[model samples]
Structures are given as structure tokens and as C-alpha cells.
Target: MRFSLRSCLASLLLAAGCSAHALAPRSPGDLCGFTEGRTVLLGNLVFMMAGKTTIQDGHNEAYVKQLYWVDLNTTFNVEGAIPPNVLHSTDIPSSAPYESGGAFFAAGNTVFIYAGLMGNSRYDWMWSYNAKDGTWSRAQVDGGKLNVDHRFAGLSAVAPESNLSFFTGGWDKPITGTVVFNATDAADTKWTNVTRVEGDDAVGSPRIANGGMDYLRLGKQGVLVAFGGYDISKNGTNQTETDHDLRPMDKINVFDIDSSTWYEIEATGEIPEARSAFCTAVSAAPDDSSFQVHMYGGRSRFRENATSYDDLYILTVPSFRWIRAPTTGLIPWTEDGVGRDSHKCVSWKDGEMVVFGGTPRKDDKVQKGCSRNYPPIRVLDTSKLQWQKQFERTTKYTVPRIVSDIVGGDETGKATLKEPEGGWANSKLQSIFSQTVARRPDITEVPIPPEPTDPPKSTIPGEEPNSSNTGAIAGGVVGGVLGVAIIAGIIFFLRRRNKKKNDNSFAAATPAAPPAPPSMYPDQQQIPMDSKDDAYMQLPGELHGQTAVPPRYELDSPIQSRNRTVFELDSSARER
Candidate 1:
């Protein structure tokens, strides 16, 4: 098996417990402003509260039980009890099955809580709480018609520059649209249904069980994004693949408010495996480039004692990658505490995503709430990706087992609960457990770069020339013609020259022929006489450079005479 370089490195990191999910301790510098396992700091004091969710509306702190105003910049001593006044009676919507309700926003001093689901019934009324006057007023649904019967599955609100509130996502029933309401001007309450995505693949299916969460403004450059929720059919019992379709959606459907269209982005990497009824929070660093969306503990696999994970993940925008966050060495809960689900998550200052107020494990036989429960307030820092236990210092509250419609804190500049500006109440926050009136801090917003509409240009190398290139036909023909002509000229010259120097010259250079042939018979042949009789002698230079020659044999000797006589006798016999 060939392992990639990346896989090897990942394995090494995991082995060393240096990975994001591990409980290894981080360095001191990594802790920055907050320490590991520290309480959540609101303005100056740290809160340890459970069972109740909180948000800021201006100078007023709104919870399920009461509404109060506090100077967020100062510390509240037990002696100096801040004035607490009840907003909703314990019996009014009395233990409304809908634990999730209340939407908080500061519009020129007025904080409004619109129709949140009261138990199973969808509340048609809007309740307005004024921070400046410290009073509550009921808001009218301008169209004279509101869906009171069908509880909204998910609701999102954004305060555009116009100070108008736009809510979208039809929940509970199959309402495929959005509504725009102007709380500042009562008459401007108008519900305009936006277009829904067309298909059996619509994300709006199995609406009842799944809750909604997202950013209000949908555009390419929009800072907000929406994600996971519970789906009854999909996450519910007797769920066939087709019967339940919403528990874990692979596609993160985004609504481009600017284009008024829906875009589905596919998620990849070591992302949290498919699960629903989870929570998300954002952490914006001093340098905006470090901004991230963090997903924390959730129920992925349902069981009788199915533990909610303490795993933390951060989605880095712009690059669009999910990175495991570094942890500050803290455990999720004591070994004895029970695992949790259906919780509220919010971000605190110093780069922490504080999750608080969730319900207990649901039993199949008894479906209302779980018997074994957990601490109400648990703060998780995405930067650290660990849970800090400060339940002792915060409010002591138990599980409120329902989705909170409004979860935002005061962001206004004032000191009164007048502006729950930053914390859980930022416009970007989906629904949470409660609402309040403290100044909310400004969450660092990330602006997405515009998508490129044009296609990328090719970067491949083009064809080039080397030594072999030439005009093939012309070059070959020209070379062949020149070669033939040169050969012909040489051949013709050689033939002419050879004819001029022919055989006539050969005869002149020949020696004279012998005068006559010798006669064949010995009697007819003339024999030369001895030198004394003929008187023939050698002349000077007659034979060039010749010396006097001696006769080859002696005239008479025993062996020679005998050999010659025998040879003569043999010749005479042959002749006869």
C-alpha cells in the first residue's frame, strides 16, 4: 500500500496526540486571553448559568422567567440586587412545550420577540420590549393573517441597513418561502414568499423534526452561512432512507439574498460525520483572516445512552476548509455526568464558543425529556476546541427541552440591558434558548470574495520547433535535382576524356614483335657454333648493368655425365 505524504504526516500527528481532536495540552501562548476550563466572561463578570438561555435586547436581560436591566460594564454585587421584573408569567404560555422561542433585535431602542413556537402551536403574535422605556408591547401581524397552527421549523432574521427584519425558511409544515417585517413601522409588516428550490431533493422536506439555523443575508459576499438541524422523520423512528431525509444533509444549502437564489455547496474533508440537532458558533480574531465558523458537540448516532461528542471543528472561510481546532486541555464533562443533546451554543469574548442550556437524553419509552442530565452551561472554545467547566459560577438551571426561537445578546453601545449587543444576540446567530438586554459585542464578519464568472485560461505548453523542421517537399525535390545533375555532368566528362586517350596510344607504347618463330624440328633449327669459331663478343652497355654469365653445369663429371647420359637415352627412346 502506497501512502501519500499527507497521510503519513496525519498518522504521525495522531500518534503524538498533537491532532485537533486529541485532549493534549496546548502551549501558554495558545491560551491567549482565556485559560483552559475557565468561566465565560460577560463584559467583566463570568456567568455560570444552566437550564436557561440568555440574550441581549438593549439594557434589558430577557430569559424564560424574567427581564432585567444591568450595566454590563460594571460588576453586580449580591447586595446591589439589580431590579428584576417578570416579562412572561410562569403560567402564561406556562411551560410552553416550545423551549425554543424568542427572537431578539435592537431597532433604534426597541427589541422585538416575534412569533416563536409556543409549545406545538405557532404563536402568531409579536412581543416588543423597549430598552429605553423598559416596557413590553404586543406587535401586530400586519397582513391580518399569520400561521398560528403550524410552528415554524426554522426562522432567520437579518436587520438590513434599512432596519427591516427579513425572516425565511418555512418550518414544521412545507412552507417554502420567507417573510419580511418592519417592526419599526407597524404597517410595513409584509410577508413576501421567496422562491423555494425545485426538486424531490428539496432541503425543506421532513420539516417537522429539523430546526433551522443560518445567516440572515444570503449573497456571495454575505458574511453569514446556515447549517444543521433535527429532522423528525430523518432522525426519528421507523426512518427508511426515503421516509426521513433531513437528519444529516450532505449539502449546505445557502440562500443568496442578493440573487434571490439557492446554492448548495458540497462539504469535504474530516468534517463532522452526518448528524443533526447540533450547534455552531463563530470566532473572529483580531486579524479578520483568522475568522472561523466552529461546530461543536452534537448527537450523530442516536442511542439509549448515545453520548454527545465533545469534538470541535472550525470552518475556515475564503479557503473553505475544515480544520480541527487546537484545544486548551479540558475534558467535556466529569466521568459521572450524563451526555447531552438539543443544546444551545453561543460565542463568548476571547474566542470561545460557549454552549449552554440543552435538554437531557430522550428515552424511546418516555419521549419527553431524559432522566440523566448534564450541567446547564458549558463553554467551548473553537480556537481551543475543548469544553470548559464553569457550571458552578454560572446560573444553576436545568434542561429546557425545546428549540429556542431567538438567541441574541445586546450589541448596542449603551450600558443598560438596553443593548445585549454581542454575545448570543448577534444578527448572525440562529435561534437560541433565551433573549437579554446587554450590549452585544460586534462579531467579526468575513466578507467572501466574489466568485469568478470567467473560465480559467489554459496553461499547457504549445508546440515548438527543433533541428529537424524544414519545407519537406520543396527541400527534397531541390536536393534530388542538384544531386542528379552533378552526377550526369561528371559521367559525361569522363566518357569524352576516355575516348580521346584510346587504344591507338597503346600500340605506340608496345615493344617490337619477335622477327620469326623458331622451327619445331631439331634438324631444321640452326644451332649456334662455339664462340672461337663465330668470333662473337659482348659489347659495352649492350646488356644494361649485366655481368659476364657462367655456364650452368660442368661438361663432364661422374655423377653429371651419368645423369645427362641417362636423360639423353630416355629422350631418344621417347622420340622413337
Candidate 2:
């Protein structure tokens, strides 16, 4: 038994009152924002809620439900709110954030979170937040009647104007039914299941997990643009996550919002190293003529080691080309290069991507040269194609040079790339991507109303988000008086894995629906430890950077595993 600081830290996560899912709390400021959480855009303000984070230390790191918001403009800062009645895990508090995949949509003044796994722990599996009062409460899904079974790591799209959101696919086989939630009448909002036959993998062809997708307005039709994820069937015979397929980002999957069909589109460019469990954010040219998706840090596990990436890539629509965006603000944590994964990305104020909490791979390497380290919360300004150390905090958005070059830029922005070489040749595909909306000065119309879909469920309709009365806004790391002070003494122990032999069995979490019998937590499979008496749970990931190929399988560390999270170690082998 290699019991030392490494395992000791892992043991601390379940420190009596903290609950089994709690990871060790790193000293403050080691990282920023939330990782593996859900994000929604409501106006210029982007709200980042849940996942894993190290806040002001008053609440449990695992169960404390903390909500953080970025104003996008006016200030380079992030403020948070402890929504009343935040959830916790088993024998823990109630109402914790979805561990990984949950449908988070923002419509009207409310943010609706309809989660299947962890949410099962609460009577109200679907929770809603009123941005108006900075309060969190329960929302209904057709009188709490969820027609479809519990699903996680699925695909989703939200249409604000129509007050409808679509979700399909689950962690197991690709789900045929499309789950529709109409928020037209908030109180009476209902869930409609557009059922499909199983075995028709093409039903939501490539409905893989841990990938990225966003709603787009091509021509005049609304489409869901998706990229990168892994299929369970792809897991090799080894049965161990030690090896698996890392989906390529260059390949694009298109889901037509109106038609309920899936299309595969071709792209030409340098293929980014295949990966899964990564984070993504998309922005469109002001005209809706072209769209660009920024793929940020994610992991790739093979052999005995786990690898996460720190670079960024841009996938543009129509031309359908892959362009690696320049990334250099945050310090490179390992030889693999600032490896990060299981984080969230939000397209912010005029074409910038704001990233929140990401755990870099734990490797002891100086990266060869001198570099400045930025906080866990990062921002990328596409207009200039460079990473910004802080938020731009301005309302105006300049078209990305890459987008303008392919679609056609303005006066000084000369278009250089030739027309796309036969990517959208199919009629059905052409009709979709070529679809366009008329923009007349008299009527403020966008190619795709940047409001609901493209800019996404993020743009709230009124008032600059005032956090003064909300949670404390950290400075520098995020911004504010307690910013540097809050995280001064903490170190992080970010991830954990089971050491039990033959732990190779893929433990799938059995998720239940609400009417409550447990605490809030998504589906996580359970497994046995080496010592029968000292059992710990196995999730879909690895320790020390979450390098597991599968979704970080939900691991409710009943023992030592939960302790290996959040803190960075100065010495000792970060036990696998």
C-alpha cells in the first residue's frame, strides 16, 4: 500500500462531513472558475454554475453549489452567488451540479437545468434559476413527468424565440427519441418525446459523448453544429480505459433543428490531435455568413499515461476548414503543453471565448522557457486570434480574421482563401448550410438571431449583471478585494483513480428519476477496491488530471479516491 501524501490527499476528500464525492480542496487561487460544469448565455452575461471548484472555503467543495458569472464587458472580473439551497451528494446535502452531461438552457429570465444522473437525487430533477433575483429553485418538466429514461452526455439545442429546446442521445447507445421541452408557459412547460427506433444509430448518427455542439442559422434554417466525441463501442477489448478512440475535431456533424436529421460534413485542414471530454464555444460572423467553433483544452488517454491539451482550434462552417488558433497566455503545466480538460467555454461580448475552471495534466516540466501563468478562467479574442490574459469587457465584436478570410472580409480585410472545395455538395446539406435570413436595416434581423442560438441561451434581455449585491467577485485570479487573498494558502489535488485490480469492468451509473430517494448526482458506476473493507467508487476518469478515455465515470469516493482533487503537489509520485 503506497500510502503517503498522494493517497493522504485522496483520503481527505471524504473528510467526515464533506461527503464521498468531495475532492480535496486545493489552497485558493491555484485554478479559476468551475470545471466540468454547465454554462448558458443570457444577454452579455455568461453564467457558469457547478462542476468542481475551490471557492472561499465556507462550504463543502463537493456539495457546495456555487454560481459564478462573467459580465463579459465593463470589467475583467467574475462574481459568484451561492444560489439558495445548493445541492450536495449522498449522506450529503441535496441539489449538486450535474457531474458531466445535463441539458442547461436559458430562456426568458430563467435558466433551466434538466439533468438525468446526479439530478435524480432531487425530487425536482430539473432545477431553474431566476437571474432576476439571483435565486435558484425547482422548475417542472411536464408535471415532473419525464417520458424518456435518464440520459447524460447527450446532444442538445435551445431556441429562445420559440421557447423550445431539443435533446437526443445518451451515454449508452445513441438514443432515437428527441426530448423536447417547451418553455413558452414557464409554469406549464412540458417535455415532448419525439421517439425514434433503436438500432438506427443514424437516428442521431454519431451521438457520441463528451463532444461539443451549438445551434446555428445556416441560410434560414436552424442547425446544430457538432464536433468531437467518443463512442462506447469504440472501446478496445482491453475493457480498460487505458486505450480508446479520441474523436477528431476536424470532422463536423450537422443536426438540422427543423428536420430532425443528422448530416456529416467534410472539412479540410490540419486535424487537431484526436481528443474527448474537451470544452467548446462558437461565434458567427456578424452577418451569419460563416460560423467558427473554438475547441479548447481536453484530454486523450492511451498506454499507461493520460494526456490533456492546452491549445485551441477553430472549425469554420461552409468552408468547413480547421484552423488552430494561437494560444499562449496560460503557463504550460506539462510537456504535453498546458494540458486541460473537462472545462466549459462561453462565447462572450462580441466574439471572445471565456473559459472557466480547467485541470491541467500533472507533470513536472518547466516548459523549457520563461512564461507567465494566467488564471484558470481564460479568454480568447478571435478578432485578433490571440489569447487575452484578462476579459475585453467591451460590447463591440470584430469579425475573426479567419472567418473573414474564408467567407469574404471587408475593405482592409482582403479574402484570400479560395471558395470551399465541394464540401456541401448534397442537396439536403446545401439547403441547410446555404439557408440564410434576410437582414434589413428597417428590421433588426441576423443570419441566425445571435440572440437565442448562436450567441446562445446566454444573452439575457436586460440590465448589466450587477454582482455587487451577489457573491464576492475575486480579483486578479477572477477580480476583486478577496481575489488573491482567498486562495493564498491552498494547493490542489485535482483527480483520483481506483487501484483495485481488474477494475477494468466498465461500471455504468444507473440513474433514477425524481420523487427523490437520494442526494443530487448524475449516474456514476460503483466498483470494489483492493481491500474489501475499504471500498471506493470508480468513475469514468483517471486521477491527477482526469486522463480517462471514457467520460469521467461518476466516482463517489466513499474512501480515498475523492481526496485526490484540486491541489497541485510539489513532490511525490501522483499515484495513478
TM-score per prediction, in order, is 0.45, 0.61
Candidate 2 per-residue lDDT, tens place, 322-354, comes to 887775543333244456676667776336777
Q: Give candidate 1's error at residue 21 in angstroms.
A: 32
What's the C-alpha lDDT at position 548 in model 2?
A: 13
**Which structure among the candidates has the greatest TM-score?**
2
Candidate 1: where is the Cα deviation over 4 Å? 1-108, 117-125, 141-144, 147-171, 182-191, 196-212, 216-224, 230-243, 285-287, 301-307, 336-338, 360-373, 386-576
> What are the root-mean-square deviations of the candidates from the true structure over C-alphas?
51.5, 20.6
List residue ranges in candidate 2 displaced over 4 A.
1-33, 56-61, 77-100, 119-125, 135-137, 147-150, 170-176, 195-205, 219-221, 233-244, 328-336, 364-374, 402-420, 437-576
Please give, for residues 1-576, the per-residue lDDT of candidate 1 as tens digits: 123433443343334322212221111111001000111122222222111322211111112233222222221111111111100111112232222332333244444444344434444455554433344566555553443433333444344233445444433443445554554454344444455565332343223233334342212333335555444433346332213333444345544444344444454444555554455665443323223566665544333233445556655332334555545645544444333444545554434555544433322110121111133345553433545532111221111111011111111111112112232222322211122212233322222122235422211111212225345534644655454445444444554576775433221333342232111111222322211121111110111111112212111111211112110001001000
Which model scores highest in lDDT? 2
Candidate 2 TM-score, true structure as reference? 0.61
